[model samples]
Target: MSHSIEITPIDDQCPLLHQTKKDNIEEAGKINGQYTNKSANHIIDEKLKDLDKYTSKKFIAIFKVNVGLRKSNPDAYTPMLISIGPYHKKNPQLGSMEKYKLMYLRRFLQRKRGLDVEHCITEIEKLKGIALKCYDDIENLDNDIVDKFSEILLLDGCFVVEFIRECSGMKPNREDKIISTNCMINLVLRDLLLLENQLPFFVLTKLQYMTKEVDEVPITKLVKETFFSILPKMAHASYLEREGDVKCIKHLLQLVHMSSHPSYYNSLWHVQDLSLKIISKDQDYQTWHANMPNVTELCEAGVRFSKVGNTYSDLEDRTTLFDIKFENGRMRMPCFEVDDVTETLLRNLIAYEQQTCDVLPKHFSDFAVFMDYLID
Candidate 1:
């Protein structure tokens, strides 16, 4: 007896499989159609709705050091002793300075005589919105955030004002531990110059005007002297003594940058067109050449180095660090001493110019690029 078994095709046996696939395809088509039919104008309108909430005034000047740069040298960018602004205010390592800030605040109030602590809080509150706007990462800080921020501004601003006053020889508080010790003062100065450690210039100016006597040295002069005194010997000589009043400085680091290149800050030297000048319009491309060798290679090529005898005052009008002169096969350049503070100072200056964009010229950035090319 022979028996035969019949096998049906999968599709024929299971008709629902085809229907399920067809349903899936139709649903996918509907989703794709919805995406494709979105009009450009409608999409733009939806985007514009978010723009109003994020449309900020250009109050943000200070910025955290970018990750790329910070990765190589984290210590250069981080504050060790104290935090000045909202960015690093919560670091546990810097908590010790908070008490000193309060102490400075009390002294500041004493200097003002009748000005109560509430008055300081109120004044800071008035500018709290504007001050908060000065930071880029304060989006989460709502109007209710004003109270905490106001307290920070009050304490930090008073600390800075008092420190500057003491540094400038206004009156020394012998009992104060921070300003009294030379090492502590130096550390504080370094911390204050960090890129993230900054307060708005106007805030410090307001505090200075409120507390300072009519006959006292202006805050600008005091700041200039204090900063110059703390910098290394080479940077001290590099400072170009300004004749007139100081320009509107944004922070202590800005003051350092301006002091280093006064002509550029004072508008005496405008941004030079750094582009290679075209000799003729007919020339499609300009030939560029730079053979900057290392000191060893340059020595082998019969080049000699000599210290530039010209003082900072002698070359006050020049705007670049590349103020070199080649005479008799010897390259004469200004002497610059690089010490512990040099790296931190330079990194902050470059960070400032990088973030400020249109607010200040990119002198430091240009210098860094120039140096990189030479090193390469």
Candidate 2:
């Protein structure tokens, strides 16, 4: 006799599964290095010294951002978390995020052998100032891609694109923040915001100090050229942005994801400088795409968009992203597939961030309880 039985799937809505709404801030925080490690600072300083032999100011932002993320009271929706990359633990069961967080936090806040601890006060001060400023800018932070793009533009010749590809891939917590290829992408972009301009100097100092950190030839040479260059362009880019030249603004914003070498960066730059020159008007990509069938690769990074109450004016010329573009009088968009850990965290952060931005007085009792439990 043969028997057939049906296998029942777990319901996401089941309370036993806790559903996604049960905010796990404490758990996430615990993984994000919320615990105290007494000897943490000394080890961090040593790590910083070792890294400095390879690069200067490299660990500054690494530490600054690392500490910023660490020091941030999780109550603020400013919960943009960062830590070691997915590759850190080949096996999750054997590897512990707790140890990783301890080291990561220590590295950011300590000063060891390589540092002229007495004379290094000024350099540390500079990092603190910039980091504090960024925190202040949080309220004014534009969620639109253009601001990010424009910020990149203020740097030299697609250098950010080059630098990011080289440095990124960190996560604070091991257990829940799911690692993916996209995480790598965000890692590069976010870190670039901190270390982009300083990359070239960082490279030279790093190479002289630690010869075997990585082995990429052309990338090394290119970094040398960019670090030495890029200063003059910042002035011109600043001028264009202040004028609200939509084309120039959008073009620069797109550059965050591009570089002088990348085709996308080249394509986007061409569209911004020469394309408008040819069109003889402040025409956006919407007007250009109507006549041109192909989308330039560069424009992908900077995009024109409208959300709730804001307009990314710099991204005006990017035209609607093809996904959001219309075809044959119909519209299409990627399915918002839920049920992933990162996606869930992103949604949670987005919702919390939105609430904070929208109201001065926001509730955090539940969030606090959740976060406290995780850290405790």
Model 1 is weakest, by summed lDDT over 10 consecutive residues, at 270-279
Per-residue lDDT of candidate 1, residues 1-376 (tens digit) = 9999997786575343244675365445455563323454577889899766652747576677888778878899898898998888768999999999988888888886689998988888887777777777666445544458888888999999889887877764555544688778878888888888998877888888888797987777777777764443323334646535543666777777766653234443221222122112233323322433445665776878786533432333342343444556675555555667767877887787777766455656655654564356
> Per-candidate RMSD vs. true structure?
9.3, 22.7
Residue 157 lDDT in candidate 1: 92
Best by TM-score: 1
In model 2, what is the error at residue 307, expressed in angstroms?
A: 23
- Which ranges of candidate 1 are over 4 A from the true structure? 1-48, 55-57, 140-147, 172-178, 232-247, 262-291, 309-323, 359-361, 370-376
What's model 1's lDDT at 361? 58
- lDDT (10s digit) by residue, model 2, range 148-220: 3322221221233223223332222242223235664353233222311122233222222222224434333
User: Which candidate leads in lDDT?
Assistant: 1
Q: What are the per-model numbers of colliding residue pairs?
A: 0, 19
